[model samples]
Target: MRHGWEGAVLKLFRGKDFTFTVTGAEQVTERYRRVHFTDGGLLQTLGVHPTMWVRLWFDNAGKPHQRAYTLVDPDVEAGTFSLEFALHDGCASDWSRKAEPGDTIEATVQGTGFDVPDPLPPRMLVVGDPASLPAINSLLAVAPKLPATIWFETTHDSDDELPFRIEDHHDLRTVPRPKMVEQVKADLQELVTADTFVWIACDTTTTRELTSYVLKDLAVPKDRVKSLGYWKAA
Candidate 1:
């Protein structure tokens, strides 16, 4: 399928396209699904980076709509990876819900990159929702040695069942949706250090609010912070 204007813009910027074949799929929860894929030489060509993502093409009313999903458990040597979808009433979620082995999808790799902090932070303050779980995992996996305080805001009952890799030194706090931002603020007040690294991904409003707080109110330098809204709340 032609990707429409958005795809054209990405192509103008030299976005590389690839086809991914679904090797397997599983329902992680009623609200979530996991799909495994062979990267079609993507892993070997572009290599891998922390929190790497790709824009997946989906059909929305016969028009190509793209959604960005972070790569989960990317195995470069095997040229395989898995993507977890927080199911909802959307074309992307609909595709994932019915995805099975042998299904193929077109994807573009563009506007996805991650840069680790020049000097590892003394403390990590992470905030996110289920939509950003894969990214949170990738960031933590790349910096397991640093102590982290994770604020995971839960919207569905199954969110608590999601996997989190918490070491002895790491702290995980599952917050109700309404209280997430305040709780994170309270924690950051105590945890923010000269070299504290803050990461946030949630609904658009919350992400913007928290990003402003960290960069302005808390005085965290831009280089020490990373924030992006994974989805917009309706």
Candidate 2:
């Protein structure tokens, strides 16, 4: 399938394209699915990193639509990884719902990289939701020894059933959609430290709001916080 204009733009930016073949699949919950794949030389060509993601091209009513998904459990030696889908009414979710062992999908690897802080922070604060769960899991996995606190917002009742890599030292807080931002605001000040690392990835508005608060109000250094708006709220 042609990737359309998005492909053209990525190509100009030197993005690497690969074809992934589905190896297996599992239903984690009514609203979540995990699909396994063999990474068509992507790992060997570019290697792997924490929180690595790829843009997958899908067919949406005869038009090429692309969605970004984080690689779950990426094994460079095995050349394989899994992608978790928060099931919803969209081309990406539609493709995942019917994915089979032999199915193939085209993916582009670009604008996907992560660097752990040069000197690891004393503590890590992560704010995300189901949409960014895979990234959250991957990020935490890289720093298992670090003490971290996570605020995960839930949009569905089944969201609590989603997998999270919370260690004994980690504090995991679940907040409903409506109260997530407010709850974080009320509680975050106490958690901030001189070198605390704040990572935020959620709906655009929430990410922007919290990033602003952390930088302007809390006076955290700009380099200590990594904030990305994962999806725009409709």
Candidate 3:
């Protein structure tokens, strides 16, 4: 299948193309699924980093569609990786819901990056939801020794079954969708300090608001905070 105009634009920006073969699939929760794949030489080519992700190309009635997914438990030597999907009403979710071994999918690598803070943060503050869970997991994997506090938003009861990486030193809170921003804001009013690294990935509006509070209200340095909108709330 051809990637169409979007692929053309990505290629113009030096995006590298690859094809992934599904090795297996599993259901983590009623609302979450995991698909395992052979990396199509992607891991060896560009190398790995914390919160690594790729743009997966899909067909929506013959038009090109793409979505970003974070790599889960990538093994460069074995050339394998996995992706976790937070099921929703969309083509990507539909694909993962029925994905099976032997299926192949096209993907592109572009605009994925991460840089660990120069002086390791004294504390890691993370705010995210199902859509960003895989990236949050990757970030935690990269800094296993750092103490972390995670505020995770859940929209469904099934979300409780989804596993989150946790260490004895980690503090985790699972909150519902309503007014999660307000709760997080109230909690962080006294938590922000000079030695904190704040990471946020959630719905667009919430990320924007929290980022503003972290930077403008709390005066945390931009370099110490990483923010991204994983999805747009509808």
Whole-model lDDT values for every prediction: 0.91, 0.92, 0.92
lDDT of 1 by residue, 181-212 (tens): 88888878988889888999999999999999
Give candidate 3 regions above 4 Å deviation: none
| Structural similarity to truth (TM-score) of each candidate | 0.97, 0.97, 0.97
lDDT by residue (148-220, candidate 3, tens digit) is: 8899998898988787888998888898989789989998887888878899999999999999999999999
- Candidate 2 C-alpha lDDT tens digits along 56-120: 99999999998899999888899999999999888899999999999999999889988897678
Where model 2 places Cα greater than 4 Å from the true spot, the runs are none
**Clashes by residue pair, model 2:** none
Write down the worst ten-residue block by lDDT for model 3.
57-66
- Model 3 Cα displacement at 103 (Å)? 0.6
